[model samples]
Target: MTNGARDENVTLEALCRGDVRTCARLLTRIERGEEAVIPLLQALYRAGGNGRVIGVTGPPGAGKSSLISCLIGAWRRRGLRVAVLAIDPSSPFTGGAVLGDRLRMVEHGCDDGVFIRSMASRGQLGGLARAAGDALTVLEAMPWDVILVETVGVGQNETDIMRHAAVVVLLQTPLGGDEVQAVKAGIIEIGDVYVVNKSDHPAADRTCRQLREMIARGSRLRPDRDWQPPVIKTQAHLGVGVAELVDAIDGCFAHQNADPEAARRYMSDRARHRIGEILRDRLDRRLRSGDEGWLEGSIEPVVSREKDPYTVVAEMLSRL
Candidate 1:
């Protein structure tokens, strides 16, 4: 093998052995879309399939970061190593992350068992970075027992990103008008556990009631329900009711593990999503690297109304 290949193998081995620096380097490479990332991710994939991937998603201002902080503590108390991938919204001008979720997780910075990484969504609309699945693969190679993925706080659109997770925790608060309606419409179904965070609010109980009703209605519509997510109230800042939330999360994980078919289905879905993403990225790269002059020529004719866009695109594809 080449020296570089050997060095990469050594790095991967160190990552699997719980080397945090190596893991961070791999994640950075993945985020930067380096060519080496593909092979590195493949190796990590082979070393993965161990960590429980939990997705935490909700609307903005739902205290997701605070809730995650509590969760990290809870998992640490159980002697389980935890890793967090917090997806932050990107600045439109600079394409850098605007809100650094890691800042909220300062307490765990010194904890050797806790690893936190903030990823920029880079304007991807689904509340996740395009490379989130690959990042998860990298984390899987590490010795973390639990991996928490926090989304970009996009309400309904957030559900799409949770498909990679084994357990989906949907956080909501008492600020409940359109937000609750959005959850009722679609997001509720994706959650394995629902948390009403900031439950110290006066409207907390009412919001919980609304969520229970929505879940009940959903359960009725799908008679073959295998798992019913429980709604737990939590004042995350105060760490109130967080233990119960952790219990619910653990129960969800246990339920998925107890059912082989369910676990297999989740894995299969994740694989399908990853494959689709990779194919899209590859096609995009190929298109961008194609004859730029030809592409501009094709677009000019269409823009000037000399040709229809559909015909131009068809002709371009035929040439390809």
Candidate 2:
């Protein structure tokens, strides 16, 4: 095995061969918030993207894990390698996650074609672990044909999936009009494919109808304006309709790639978002870096009303 610390090309080569041990170790280091992975990530970025990043997000008990497991099976049957990152809610005190999502995927444990890893959300907002993009950078460099990212089952505005994935699948269970109304507009705007899971439920069709109506009227803010988001129903646990779900996903990806204009626009938007994310994360670390004298110098004036916050912000921005 090549030493990733010394040779990023060698590491990239190993990763391209789907070196599971190396990938796992790198992800572990990244999840611990290590700074050492930066160069490797840079190399991977320059190496260019490989896998299709598919993001799955929905509310709690939406059977996202089960659906993902089934999707992995479907993709594997198509002779495609699959990787999954399941983001579990972390304990606030311990900064640890139970990783129960992994349990739901035990069926795929023996498959060499599939790799499943659970990441702690670590109190990060936007339904993902703070290290998600870093983790994704690692996976996207690997040999996987598809990389599946499952969120921590958060609410509407937290649809950070759009920033990372080329395709986003939003899941929902059967619901009445009122319950469907609770699915906020922000989430509605983010999904490239909407799914009504648990299709066996009595109100499933009604829920799908409501979703279509909402999707039809919401003025979808998607860059692929010529594309129409499809709504599919799946009984995931029974493995029913999963093939259709996969078909929809395949169709969505094809549609997004079909138009040269949409493809460029989407890529540009995603790059812009990634830049903003990196800037914010870097600035946040700098601010919270705990230089007592520098902090006291910055805060004292504001405390004494000698400096307005906006002016102080300008000063800090200039310094940073």
Clashes of each: 0, 0
| Model 2 lDDT-worst window of ten | 175-184
RMSD of 2: 2.8
TM-score of each: 0.93, 0.90
Off by over 4 Å in 1: 178-184, 221-224, 315-320
List lDDT for all candidates, in order. 0.83, 0.85
Model 1 CA lDDT for position 50: 73
Question: Clash pairs of candidate 1?
Answer: none
TM-score of 1: 0.93
Model 2, position 171, has a per-residue lDDT of: 92
Residue-level lDDT of model 2, residues 217-294, one tens digit each, is: 764544338667788999988999898989999998898788888888878988998889888988977866775577
Best model per lDDT: 2
